[model samples]
Target: MNVEVIIVLVALVGMLAALIMDKMRPGMILFSVVVLFLCTGILSPKEMLEGFSNKGMITVAMLFLVSEGIRQSGALTQVIKKLLPQEKTSVFKAQIRMLPSIAFISAFLNNTPVVVIFAPIIKRWASSVKLPATYFLIPLSYVTILGGICTLIGTSTNLVVHSMIQEAGLKGFSMFELGKVGVFIAIAGIIYLFLFSSKLLPSDRPETSGNEEEEQNSTLHLVEAVIGPRFPGINKRVGDFNFKRHYGAEIKELRRSGHTYTDLGNIRFREGDTLVVLTDDSFIRTWGESSVFLMLANGKDYEPAGKKKRWFALILLLIMIIGATIGELPAIQRLLPEGIKLDMFFFVSITTVIMAWTKIFPPQKYTKYISWDILITIACAFAISKAMENSGVADLLASYIIGLSHSHGPYVLLAAMFIITNIFTELITNNAAAALSFPLALSISQQLGVSPMPFFVVICMAASASFSTPIGYQTNLIVQGIGNYKFTDFVRIGLPLNIITFLISVFVIPQIWSF
Candidate 1:
């Protein structure tokens, strides 16, 4: 390898270590590493910044607003209420009643908000019915993830991969193209959950299920608080911050990057650190809207979407999906010029503006809903991937893989791609994992002298099937906090599902998108 290739390889390793170690945010780490590569003359500024303006990245931003409108409109709430069993009996029966609807809803909406809205409600419902909240919360997150993989817009990761495909000068994914394999994966995941979750998942809540009376009487609550720009404790050590005096909350654990820290004394406060606090309900009422904190989990009530507005939001969502899917048909696509054809980006942009104009979600507060860190990570990923290509790192790696797996056929290469992407997703964000893997996947296809379709599909499945750990996906993190689960809890429940997805995806993707 050349000096530049070696440097890029070393930088890649360090980036992974930092992300897994939780020393800094993934975006920050990735951006910093790419900058170093740029400084060494490996990547041009244009290539580095291309991802920032990518249709995929912008689509994710627009979808955040769209999801917010649906969330604030209370449309999903009505649907969920109808779907949940009125009287829950056993964990298995409740799951049978609840998980499918959750998956269906999540397939359309963003998974994070779906979990955010459902976790507490399911907890409360499980409590009222005298069943364990733990049984339902993790499955709720998993099903949403499964559902997300079913459509092009189901998760930001799919969109990012599609964007990469387009950037490579290939025809991008149709709206439901991924659903060919994704729907099957979702069905398989649901089956796995129904068969094994009751036995493997925790049967009791760490605390009393979301009972108001019990919550009111309890001396402490495990609440999550996001540090806002206005937080005064920034740059101060946790021990010196006097959190109890300023916010009336005591920190029990701190989650940054993907690592959880309990050693508050030595850690410095930073914006975006999710502090798991031990506080009472009163703390929520008192500081719920304070500028010092961006968001307080389980604190504020979501205003139900007004009657007329709720229907409007749901209709707008359907229009985006249906219009985009129909627009991609050969007949309709032929009508429009290739340069400006109707696509998911077009539909999503129009839907967002209409929703904003109608005030489905407050337009002024739209930026808060976007996950800026994820966007930054994705944008930087494009640069890093470009660096890998330019510096010969991707080619070098592809040569080794081809040498080792040539005897086993392209299936081995596809399996390797899936395994690497899934491991990266577990360590970092799904979008970032997809970004990093795409160039290498393309290189492998070129090396093997076959179609790249199966490789592309593998990246989508592997990057999004992050079921082995809470840090693998954001939805997992949200559910972990709400369910009060330990690390092993995920391993016990998720490993089998991961294996099932692996088998299904590896076996099915090649058949449909043949090499």
Candidate 2:
């Protein structure tokens, strides 16, 4: 290989190491690598920054506003109250009643906010019925994840992958195109959870040092926080970091991967480790905006601030989905120029503006609602994919995989791609994992002399199927802290579902899309 290719491969290795090591945020890590490639003249400035203006990137941004508007309007919360019967006490009965609806709603909304709105409500309901919140919280997160895979806007990862497809000069996914394989995966996942989650999920909540009376008070915040790259306590043992003094928060528990640590004195802070913490209302003001925590679940649901505009927000969202889906029809495509056409980007942009104009969600706070870290990670992903292509690293890796799997057939290759992407997703952000895998999948398709569509669909499924680990998906992390779950809890419940999705996606994807 040439020196340029060698440099690119070396840089990729370093980037992967940093990401897996959890030394920095995925966005920053990716952006830094793209910058390195730019400075080395491997990628031009325009190529480096192209992701910023990408249709998928921008669509995700707009959807955030749309989701925010719906969330702020209180429509979903209203629907939840009406659909979930307060009298239900049995775990199986409750899940059967709730999970399908959760999945359906999550299919339309963002996964994080869906969990955000539903988690506390479900927890309160469980407490009233004398049921462990643990049983429902993990399932809630799982269902949302399953639901997210069913639609393009369901998860940001799908949109990121779709954007990469268009950039690669392929026909991008429609609004419901992913639903083909995704719906099947969702059904299999939900069934697995329904059949097995009760035994797998933890039934007891984590105990705190506080008295029963103190625990009963809602004012005593029980929250979960993930250490971010900028967290000051990185590499420092819990006893050394004096969290109570520094942030006025007590670390009740620390969980990394599948292991739970109660002996905080010896535990060092690491990125992606979930910490169940106890603090008060002031914690939101102090650390809400800090990058030190990738996520914080305060275990309190805010009342809908724009309750009056609920119907308006819901209507706008529905219109956006329907309008975008219809805009992709052949008749619609015929009317527009080859270069210009109405798609999700157009509908989402219009909906976001209407929401802002009507004050469904304050336009002033629009930027705050959008997760810049995720957007940056996605934007940098495009540059990283370009660097891989320009360096011939993608082709090189493709050749090796093709040689090894030539006899095993493309089905084996599909399974391998799914496993790699799934593993990467568990270790890093889903969108980042999808971005890194897209170029390789395309190259593998080229090497096999088959359609790349199956590879792309597998990448989408694998990246989103992060059931085995809390850190694999953001929604899982959120529920991990809120539910006071141990690392084993996820593995117990999520592994089977992970396998179920793996099997269904691998067998069914090629059949539908053809390789």
Candidate 3:
């Protein structure tokens, strides 16, 4: 490697360390690396800023609002009620009923909101049916992730990869193209969960007293709130923050990773920590929409939109998906204006505007709905990928990979790429994993003189196959805290699913897309 590659590689290692250590917000950590690249003359101003304006990044932002509108409408909550068993049910039966429908919903919408909406409800339902919430919550998060890979709009990572393909002067993934392989993976993964998840997951029941249960049924609510990056009290001692004074809620307990702290003395707050707070009726009304918390577990706290508004929001979402799908057809492309294309960006933008005008979500408070930190992380991820390519680091790494797997052929290379990407995703952000792996995948394909499509598909699958760790995916983190689970719980159950997804992606992707 030359001086530039050495510099980029050093920076890459430091960035990964910072991200793993939680030294700063993921967005800032990624943005810092991009700035380092810019200062070292490895990236231009246009290249540095290009990700901020990427169509994929913008679509993610718009989809956030669309998800928020649907979330506020209470449509998802309504759907969950119907999916759960009315009376007591077995864990296997519950998974059979709930997992597939959730997977389908997640394929159409964002995964975080679906988990945020369904997790608490499912947990509560599990309690009602005398089943362990731990058995259901992890599967809920995993199924959404499985569903997301089924379509272009299923997850932000897919869109990020699609945008990179377009920028590389190739046609991006059409709607449902990923579904060819993704559907099979979803089916196999779900079946595995149905058979083994109940036995593998812990049977710990949520602790509650008669008085606490009565209070829950009354106006007082015990809420589980996940700390967001924007929360001001992060990194400070709980005693110093004065939670009751600021948010008008009492922090009765806090759960971090898998440990529960009821004393709350001298505990420093961290992002993603779940706080079980005792709140009155006005608590959700006051902070439900705030960005301070990633999600509030009390779905019954909010007054959903009117029936007409709820149906309207659902119809609008379908229109956006259908419109974007149809726009990609060759006939529709030919009918469009010379300089214009009716892509996801076009449809999502229009749908967002209509929702705002019609008051699906509050128009004035729209900025709060968007996760700016994630947006920043994604934008910086693109720049980081470009820097790796420009500095020859991607080529250097690709050559080594090809050298190790050449005798075994592309099948081995595909497995190696999947393993590397999946590890990065398990340790850090999924988008960052995709960004880091994309250039390398492209380089490997070019070196082998094969289609890059299978490599790209593998990156998407591996980056999203973050089933083995709670930190790998946001939804996993959400469920981990509420379920009071240990890190080993994920390893025990999720590791098998990880292997299953890996096998499916390696064996099935090449068959469908051709190497």
Q: Pick the candidate with the highest lDDT.
A: 3
* lDDT of candidate 3 at residue 279, scale 0 to 100: 74
Q: Which residue pairs in model 2 clash with each other?
A: none
* TM-score ranking, best first: 3, 2, 1
Give every collision pair in model 1. Answer: 73-305
TM-score of each: 0.89, 0.90, 0.96
Ranking by lDDT: 3, 2, 1
Q: Clashes per prediction?
A: 1, 0, 0
After aligning candidate 2 to the native by TM-score, how far in Å is the CA of 250 from where it should be? 7.2
- Which residue runs of candidate 1 sit more than 4 Å off their true CA positions? 208-239, 244-301, 337-339
Where does candidate 2 have its weakest 10-residue lDDT segment? 205-214
Worst 10 residues of 3 by lDDT: 205-214
lDDT of 2 at 448: 80
- Candidate 1, residue 252: CA error in Å? 8.7
Candidate 2 structure quality by residue, lDDT tens digits, 1-515? 99878888898889888988777778899999999999888899999989999989998888888887888898988877876678846888888889999999998888877877787787777888888888888999999999999998999999999999989899989889999988888888888888888888777665443445346876776676766656788888888888999888888778765456778898888766778777888886667645667566665665665555887788888898899898899998898887876788988989988899988887886887787888999999999999989888889988888787866878998998999999899888898788779989999988789999999999999999999888777778777766767788888788888899999999999889998
Candidate 2 vs candidate 3, TM-score winner: 3
TM-score of 3: 0.96
